[model samples]
Target chain A: MASTDINSTVETVFRIEQARLIAGLTRMLRDVGLAEELAQDALVTALSEWPASGVPDNPGAWLLAVAKRRAIDRLRRAKMQERKHAEIGRDLDEDRGDDVERRDAALDDDIGDDLLNLIFIACHPVLSPEARAALTLRLIAGLTISEIARAFLSTEPTIAQRITRAKKVLQESGVAYEAPRGEARVLRLASVLEVIYLIFNEGYAATAGDDLVRADLCGEARRLGRILIGVAPDEPEAFGLLALMEIQASRLKARVGADGEAIPLPEQNRAQWDRLLIRRGLEALARAEALGGADGAYALQAAIAACHAHTGRAEDTDWAHIARLYDRLGQIVPSPVIELNRAVAHSMAFGPEAGLALLAPLETEATLRGYLPLYAAKGDFLFRAGRYAEARAAFDKAAGLSRNTAERNFLLKRAAACGPARPVMR
Target chain B: MRVMVMVKATKDSEQGVMPSTELLEAMGKYNEELVKAGIMLSGDGLKPSSQGKRIAFDGPKRSVIDGPFAETRELVAGYWIWEVRDMAEAVEWAKRCPNPMPGPSELEIRPFYEMADFGEAATPEIAERFDRLREDAKKR
Candidate 1:
């Protein structure tokens, strides 16, 4: 192979194996930062040797073996240094020997558990959300500092420091290199899922950035979700989360216009939706439901997305079914946003009056005070009800509250559609 | 993006020779890795071409041909649909796959055409027509 080809090949192999190697090493060494360093050391070794010998048959195992040997060497050197400084070095020798024996045993243990433990540690709730995302992408996804920075639209140095501080915090906190069990396991898994969804949302709809959709972030989140489901196969919520991401990702291409303007769901061209992803998502949703997680938070949302996906056109949507889902979803996790959605669903399923009745109570909601979607829904309902003056006022209010340039323009267009009011005929 | 990875047929495969136990085991492990990485959407190995039939159309004329077809190398023994970040990632994963057959073998990766690829041609009317066709086919 040419030099450049060999370099890229080695890099690809490294990317594939780095996560497992680091996870296994972290379990053995109980230090994530050091484990990552040893994984890199193994990659360097491969780069130097693989070109001469050709790629190994079992490259992943070869990388793991190399990383393990380096880890053992590092431990021995550290032990030797401690022995030199200590007056009572006799006991230390036996301790070192016992440690080596234990490390040897750990080598034969399941790598899946190690990977799961690494995920939990990286996504531990003690870390800040930003830190969790940065660390998880760096460790689990095998993404470099710069790659993560580019994904999140942050400065490279900022991301680097965030990751460094995150590692230091994990070490200082002395988080166990083991997956939690029982109730603790449930909470920790929730934290992991939350981080994954947060990453997906940041990509699906950038809250603060100019780019509305960052496909890379969504892809990473989906990858992470799949990994989570793989390791925790019995967890239905994992399947639910994966299903939700897949279905939502299916619409990514249809969600924007040529100028990158936001295209609301109703207006989006359904042809652009990714059918394969939708199929995968529906299958996953079925799995989640079969696992008796139909009532689960993520599963409920996935069901809603599936409703949209199952329909060929927006007007053909089974809004009554969606409204019932929102009713159930609202019961489980009450939110003003859910109420707003329920209103829109009711509007579609019944008439504009039904939606207006639902939206009336939400007007005093502190959280929904300036929420753009609320007014947008109200204006839509009012316009359909032939209350042009009220619809114009509501749309104007919605347009004023809009953040995205595309969304503001769309709302302004709606407001303008409601022309001057004429006197009512007696 | 998604790609269909086809394991090209060789002489042994065309003759209905089953994979050795070791090869099967290696492929199993490779598939598990793909699933865990959230790449493999669907995959299956096909029986030898002898059991398959093809139809040819020339204007209004229709002709039927039975397999085993000629040009064994062009025939597919198996295929997988994988969702990957890009073609490079797909290629990397494909490179990691075990040799699909005994002796020299080949794998081909072809990306599926995405809806965006159709540009303005993929109108709602066309999409709905395709949807109806799909539903009709499924019903049949």
Candidate 2:
């Protein structure tokens, strides 16, 4: 690589591995903010040294090594006498300037498994869902505040403040920098799973912007799920989450056209399905089931994914089973979204009226008041039932609520199909 | 052990928005449960930050600063002091407290010190006496 190319590549690698580096540093420093600052200091050292030293074989290890050395120097500078009591790990007997090798080894080994623990700590429910999601993307995914802000259609300062408050909340709660066990584990685990799911959904269906898929988000979310799988192999919900993501992600290649337009699932080319990912997803589902079927929310969702994976054609799907699974899911966790989904399955299984009956009750719900999918689903059922006027109104409402160019276009097309709501400025 | 359950305050809570009238009745019942179980020592709400002051001392100088501190994040609007056997028991009580900030709030359970906390040979610098003095003065 050319010199400048190599320099930029170093920057990119550091950014990619930023979370692992911070996780390592946070363990050593015990302060998330300070750990990040120290990690940045290491990045600064790299920008100045890599060109001169020609980039180390393992750049991540090199950054970790540099940060560790800096940490010891920092501790010494902060008043050695105070840290002396805490320095049972340190050979304070040796000259303070000497024994750099000892400090590096001590610092490096203690933080090897810390990154995953940091993810759990960051995702603790002590913070709001927004805060937990933002913090996870920052600490585990290694995303910049601006990068995160851009992904969510939010301002940079707002994202920054959200992250700041999240860290502060965890600290004030004394939530600890370690993973929980027993019932406490279950409480915090739900929040952690939700954050990862949100990250994946953002990738699977970009909330805003012209593009139908933001593949970068998919890669980040997948990486996070993979990490969770490794960290909590026996936790069935974790496996279920990873499995669901894998199966869903398996369809990504065919979800968009060459022109970057959205491709509805039925119309997409199945030949483009990633067989390897599908296999992995199937295996994860098996693992989740093997672990047990009274599975947590994520595992139940995985079972739903498996039904889709096993089908050869969209029309051949066992909608009856899907409806049953949705019913089971509703009983397990009552949510308006789940009810909406169950209604769709009911339509597919029985008839449009079956679905409409389920959906009509949700029409007056405060939670579903502004949700686009509620209108979209209602419109679909009405159109299939041959109520063109009702379908047109529902579709128009969906189109108004939706901001995604592709989604809005799709809904408008459905509205136009009812014949008479010819395309206008709306 | 006397565990002090610190209910982190919010702007709405401090405005005498004492839960809803319905929630107040639910809370009265919950407090009854606490009393029946013999855990509730004391519990009540505080006035808004508009009626509060933050005092800072540097050497002999004292700056008494005055509240709706509008700093929603820092306000500790109310608390319930409970004498619990251990941390686990304290958590159980906190779980039962009527959701203090139905809109946006949290309850923090912290352990309080007893008189025997300052036993023989305790260093003056790190003494419980100084800590107790700071705690008493702050509440005043």
Candidate 3:
């Protein structure tokens, strides 16, 4: 193969293997920082050698073997350091000996705990939310620092530092390599789900990109959600999360118009929805409900999604039922966003004035003062109520606040369409 | 095992317009049929031309062109990644697809490359690695 072809193939292969390689090495080394470095070393070796000798027959195994060897070298170096410390009459931590034994036992079996632990650690509460997201994508998604930065629309250096600081914080804190136990387990699991959901939301509605969706990030998050379910089969919230994502992802294909402008849910063609995904989502929701998790936060969201997924046409949606679900969801995890969504549901279920009444109190709420969607929602309700000039002003405010080019243009178009004459509701 | 089913773009698609509710429901039902029959792995619709971009390369130099491309007929409005028994099966399923646009539209089926097509170069060992990778992927 040509050099460029070989390099590209190797890059693809590396992405597939890097997570496993790092996870395995972390099991042996008991250090996420060292494990990542060893994985990168293996990648560097592959880049330098593969072009000359052609790609290996079992490149993943080859990379794994190479990374394991690096682990052995590191163990030797650590042992030497310990010996020197002893010779100098300096005392090392008592846990050092036990760590070696645990690591040796880890090297003997194929277990998935390393990855599960890594997920928990990446979302550990010590790191900032943004840092946790960046680190999670880097370690679990096998995304490069630059790739993570690009996905989040941040600078590469900023992402690199975020990841570096995350690893440093993890190592310094001496975070355990096993999943948290008891009540802590529940909290950590929630964090893990939050990180994955955040990633998925970024893909589902890219905040600033020209494109309405970023399928790569969505696919990554879905894969991670499935893995979470596999690892934590008894966690009903995991199923709830998977259900919510699957149903939302099912609509991704139908969410955009031909010219790439964001199409409102009611305007999208229902036929374009992915039925398989919807089925999987419903099944997951059923699993969650079976586990008596119907009232859980994610399950509640999934219930809302079910309202949309079950309807064949937008007009046929059970608006009153959805409005009730939203009311319950708002009570459970009350936030400005949920309230905004609930307002939309109320408008659909009752009338535009009812929705506008709900929205009026939220206008001055500190948390949503600059939230573009709030204004956009208000604009829709006003336009439907035949308050044209007011709708135009709301749309203009929404247009000004939006960062996404397509969304901004769409809002501007709405602003322009707010003429004196009222259009008939469909 | 896999084929891409492309939805041909029309004038309305180029204009960044949305399909009607009736059309959306018809398409949704058709997609449900495909999903129920286990023919579709995944599918999605595309935004209009104005939201897309193309990169043309000349040697190492590349230039990016903003879309709203002039060629409406050549553009793709949507697509499905389908798994069918054969090309005949894929074609049969395509025939049952609902009209995705208000005006006449086209659906084209194209097969994906299989590992067997690589012949000698796709050694058993190489295939094994891919299988291992796929298995590992599930854990991520």
Candidate 4:
């Protein structure tokens, strides 16, 4: 094989194996940062050797073996520093004699636990949100620094520093390499779910970019959520999150048109909607509810999504049920976003005037002032009520606030459709 | 039983930039829809052509060519391997695929060759080899 082929092949192999290698090594080393370093060392060795000898049949095992060897070497190098080093050093030395089998057994025994624990550790509350995202992507997703930066629209050096500092914080705090139990476990689990969902949300909405969506981020988040469900089968929120994302993700195809214009839910081709994702989402929702998480934030949102999923068209959507679910969601989380959504649902279930009544008061809300969706929702309600002049103004405001080109175009179109401003009858 | 849906590459996809979350979610939902309908076998998006490679064969002389291939319109960005009843069914399913790209995208669906289609061309030896190959594939 040529050098370029070998390089990319090695890269693909490393991408696939790095997470598992690090997960297993973390069990042996008890330090995520050190294990990652050792894994990198193995990758380096593969780049140098695989070209000469060709790729191995079991490349993952080969990389793990090399990483383990590096771990043993490091333990010997740091022998005099701590009793912890001495104990791990002795363990590594014994394991090396029966290397492949023992290593495989160790991997089989705690692979799931180790991966789940690593996720919690990466998302430990001690770190900042940015750091948690970078660390989680690096460890679990096996994304390169540049890849993470590109995905998040940040620079590589910035992401690199965030990851480096995050690892330092984990080591300095002496965080355990196992999932915490009791209330602490619940809190950590929430943080883990938050980080993954945040990643998915960013990809879905793209807060600042010109584009309306980022499929890669959503894909990564869904993949991570699925992994979490596999590793923590009993966690209802894990199921809830997967269900929520699945239902939301299912609509990605019909969200925009050929001209890159935003297609509102009512305008989207319901026939184009992914029924498989809807089914999986509904199944997940059932699982979450069966596990007694029906009132959970993600589960509630999933229930809301299910309302849309069950409909054959926008008109068939159970808006009243959705409004009730949003009410429950508001009681639990109490955000303006939820209120706005509830208002929209009320408008659909009740009347445009009712929705407008709720939205009118929110105009004075500090949080709603700069929120684009608020104005957009208001515009929709007004348009439905035949308050064209007001609707046009609301849509104009929405267009001004939006960063996405497609969304701005759609909003502007809505504003234009409202037609010439009418003179006041008074 | 199977068809391949090839999503032609666009300038944006060729550049390695990411798609927005909205599109991803929509496609994810669409994929779920396909799966729920029992029409989808498997699907995936591909990295840009710069990360790809091709091999040209001239009678036993094979040559490797790294990608960033010039024909953006002709290049494939991603594909879906689907299981459907027939070519018409495959085309119907293709019609339901999301735009895939923000501006404009195209999906070309082609039926896979079935052993039954070969008929008299399928000698006993060839059939046995095909059976062995399918069995081997299942092991993986």
Question: Model 2: per-residue lDDT, tens digit, A288-385?
Answer: 88988445677778778778777766767799998998999999999999999999999999999999999989989999899999999999999999
Question: Which of the CAPRI classes, incorrect, acceptable, medium or high, describes model 4?
Answer: incorrect
Q: Where does the lowest 10-residue lDDT sum fall in candidate 3 chain A?
A: A87-96
Docking class of 1: acceptable
Task: Give the Cα error of residue A184 in candidate 1, in Å.
Answer: 0.8
Q: Model 2, which residues run further than 4 Å from truth? A: A12-17, A56-62, A80-112, A207-214, A257-261, A386-426, B1-140
Candidates in order, interface RMSD in Å: 6.6, 32.3, 20.2, 19.6
**What are the DockQ scores of the candidates, in order?**
0.33, 0.01, 0.03, 0.02
Docking class of 3: incorrect
Order the numbered candidates by TM-score, best leading.
Answer: 1, 4, 3, 2
- At residue A170, give the lDDT of candidate 4: 92
- For residues A1-426, what per-residue lDDT tens digits would candidate 1 score against the true structure? 898888888887788778888887776677899989999999999999999998898888899778877866777777745644342233222222365565464454422466788999999998998999989998998888887777788889999999999999999998877667768888988999999999998887653334422556888899899888888787899999999999999988777655556667776777778888899899999999999999998999999999999998676789999999999999998999999998999999999999999999999999998998999999999999999888988998899998778889888899889997544333
What is candidate 2's lDDT per residue for B20-113, written digit by digit as tens? 7877788888777564333454678787777888888999999988854666767788878664445655665565567766786688888865
lDDT of 3: 0.78
Looking at candidate 1, what is the lDDT of residue B54?
91
lDDT of 1 at A12: 78
Error of 1 at A342 (Å): 1.9
- RMSD (Å) per prediction: 5.5, 28.5, 17.8, 16.9
Candidate 1: residue pairs that collide: none
Question: By DockQ, highest first, what's the ranking?
Answer: 1, 3, 4, 2
Worst 10 residues of 2 chain A by lDDT: A88-97
Model 3, range A1-426, lDDT digits (tens) per residue?
878877776776676567666776666666788889988999999999999987686676788777766666666666756755353222212222465665565454412355677778888988888888888888877777877877787788998988999899989998877657778888988999999999998887663233322445776677678767755667899889989998998887567543446767776666668787799899989999999899889998999998899987677889999999999999989998899999999999999999999999899899999899999999999999988888988898999999878889889899999974345344
lDDT of model 3, residue B39: 48
Question: In candidate 1 chain A, where is summed lDDT lowest over 10 consecutive residues?
Answer: A87-96
